[model samples]
Target: MRYVVQVFASAFRIRKIVNDGEFCILYSDSDPSIDCIYVTDKWILSNQAKPGGYYIAYDNGDSEYVEEDEFKMRATFVDQD
Candidate 1:
């Protein structure tokens, strides 16, 4: 069996698994119109800390800024059971 990993960037972006692990590493992108953040696959969970990076996976690749909100953007690494 095969499993695909994904990264939910924001509201408009979803990146595929470029790397694998509890600490996945992916590319990061940014837009210049909205008050948003760009993230990369390179990430870690709250309890864990890896490298620092981000990507604008969603948001139509535009700079349409909006109020700050929180979403449970998460990633995990473990041998499937």
Candidate 2:
């Protein structure tokens, strides 16, 4: 299963996500040590960073738009699996 996650973050980090050859690993800006989520290259809609956030369109037609702060809080404890 794959999901499209919309992420809000710095340009530098976003660039890194886009350039990564394998997959997109979302990291928390406040705590760089924490990895928020992982999106494989197969599910990515586009490598380009959009104005609102990083939009990843899911294959099942379900997508999520999350701000950096909200995502950090959720990713801290919630098991995405």
Q: Best candidate per TM-score, number?
A: 2
Question: Compared with the true structure, what per-residue lDDT tens digits does model 1 show for residues 1-81?
Answer: 999975333432222224443334433222234442333333333313222333334434532212123222342222322
For candidate 1, which ten residues in a row score worst on lDDT?
Answer: 63-72
TM-score of each: 0.18, 0.29
For model 1 the local lDDT of residue 51 reads 23
Error of 1 at 45 (Å): 1.5
**What is candidate 1's local distance difference test score?**
0.32
Decoy 1 TM-score against native: 0.18
RMSD of each: 16.1, 10.1
Candidate 2 structure quality by residue, lDDT tens digits, 7-63: 533211222344267766554333344445566655445433322343333456554
